[model samples]
Target chain A: GGIITQTPKFLIGQEGQKLTLKCQQNFNHDTMYWYRQDSGKGLRLIYYSITENDLQKGDLSEGYDASREKKSSFSLTVTSAQKNEMAVFLCASSKDWGANTLYFGAGTRLSVL
Target chain B: AQSVTQPDARVTVSEGASLQLRCKYSYSGTPYLFWYVQYPRQGLQLLLKYYSGDPVVQGVNGFEAEFIKSNSSFHLRKASVHWSDSAVYFCAVSPNYGNEKITFGAGTKLTIKP
Candidate 1:
């Protein structure tokens, strides 16, 4: 069994601060994605990487940046945190793209003050 | 654009009662549907998926979902409810053949009343 590990289960940041969250998966999946979950907005994709060094922006990629340093690691950075932007960041990976079941990390909760 | 709509934002039922959560999706061609559950302060867990073949797909924890293509809906059902089943359920859809570019609905929060 493979597990998706997310670092710093909770994040507390000040407004305008640039916070980074990390994700690591041992499943060796080819695709990794980062999503932001608001209270009632569901989950919005921020970015994804098909492979190491590859990146694709999703619907909610405006204030975020992602990096797939290695096949096992994917990281996301919040450009400038806002008070209203406090939400949970989730990381997921899939064996392949589309219609495939996704493996998810526990997620990192961000609170902006 | 591919999208999902979960009409009920919150649903409450008593233990041992039947459970149903609604999900509607939008896509021009054949669509890929999925139901995921998230426990408090946790990540989303795949409950079931519908692609091809049988209209009814079974998932973990005795959960099942039926895909009604005619109605453009996929609804999750469980015969008996348990307190552990309390969680936030999300419905999502993908346009392409596979899981590409998926969109999620706002999600339905299920609460079990004893």
Candidate 2:
């Protein structure tokens, strides 16, 4: 059994500020993903990595950057925070790639003032 | 591009009663469907998924979903409801080929009334 851990469960940033969120998974999965969750909006894929040092853009990839420096770690960076913006970012990992069940982290709630 | 739709934004059912949540999707090729549940203050968890073979897939905690290809719908159901079942449910769709990128619905919030 393994767990996906997301750092800084709650995040606060100022408008135009850059913020970064981190994720770590011990599952040793081959793929990692970053998703943004808004109230009633479900989850949107921001970016995903098939393996270390690889990245693929999703529908909502703009204004976000992701890094897969290590197979166990993935990080997301917000280019510029927007005022009154609030959302929860979730990190997930899968054994392989397509059609596999994903293991998720608790998520990091972000609030920009 | 593939998309998913969850018609019901909110659903409330009495405890021990049957439950159903509606979902619809759009895709040109073969679609892979999935149902995910998000408990309060937690990330989404897989409830069930349909790739091929069976149209009806069973999931954890007595949850199940049936895929109706003709209607382009994958609906989630439960024989009985419990208070702990209250959560937000999302329907997702993925393409069959290449690196699959999942598209999710707006989501349906379910509340169990005792």
Candidate 3:
């Protein structure tokens, strides 16, 4: 079985600072996604890429930018961190779009001071 | 637009007892439902999925979920509970068509009493 790896298990950022999170997958999947998890809000999709160099915004795409540099790697950038935006960011990959199963990474916990 | 709701935020059950977590969804077209579990310090794992045909879908670790289209509900159940079963359970839904985002519920935290 393949694995999805996310770098930087934890992140601390100051208000208005820019932070980036990276993800890599060995599954050779065609689709990758970034989701933000809040305490009571569950997981909200921020952005997704169907293939390399493709990006699509989701319900919660504001203040976030995503890049799919290659088939195996995807990255997310927080344009300007907010003090109230402490949350866990998850990276997931799927074989394809639609009703496919999503394989997820452990996630990066972010806190803004 | 599609949406999911998991009413109960937390539930505690005795060990060896039956378990059930409620989930409801709203979508205009056909809905593909899923149940995912998250253990402590771990990423989410799919427990089961309901595409079509049978309403009852079985998942790993003896977990099962029944899809009630009439009620727009999909509830996860287990015959017996164990301490290891304690975790956060999320309900998700996706449109039948491709290129759409999957929406997830708020999730329910399950606790098992030893």
Each prediction's DockQ?
0.74, 0.70, 0.79
User: Each candidate's interface RMSD, rounded to one decimal?
Assistant: 1.6, 1.4, 0.9
| Inter-residue clash pairs, candidate 2 | none
Worst 10 residues of 3 chain A by lDDT: A50-59
Tens digits of per-residue lDDT, candidate 2, B47-109, equal 999999889999999999999999999999999999999999999998987477788899999
Considering every candidate listed, which one attains the maximal TM-score?
A: 3
Per-residue C-alpha lDDT of model 3 across residues A16-111, encoded as one tens digit per residue: 999999999999999999999998899999999988878999889999988999999999999999986689999999998778999999999999
Candidate with top DockQ is 3
lDDT of 3 by residue, B68-105 (tens): 98999999999999999999999999988865788999
Interface RMSD of predicted model 3: 0.9
Candidate 1 lDDT tens digits, A67-109: 9999999999999999865789999999877778888999999
Clashes of each: 5, 0, 0
lDDT of 3 at B96: 82
* lDDT preference between candidates 1 and 2, better one: 2
lDDT of 1 by residue, B1-114 (tens): 888999999999999999999999988898888999999888999999888899999999999999998899999999999999999999999875664678899999999999
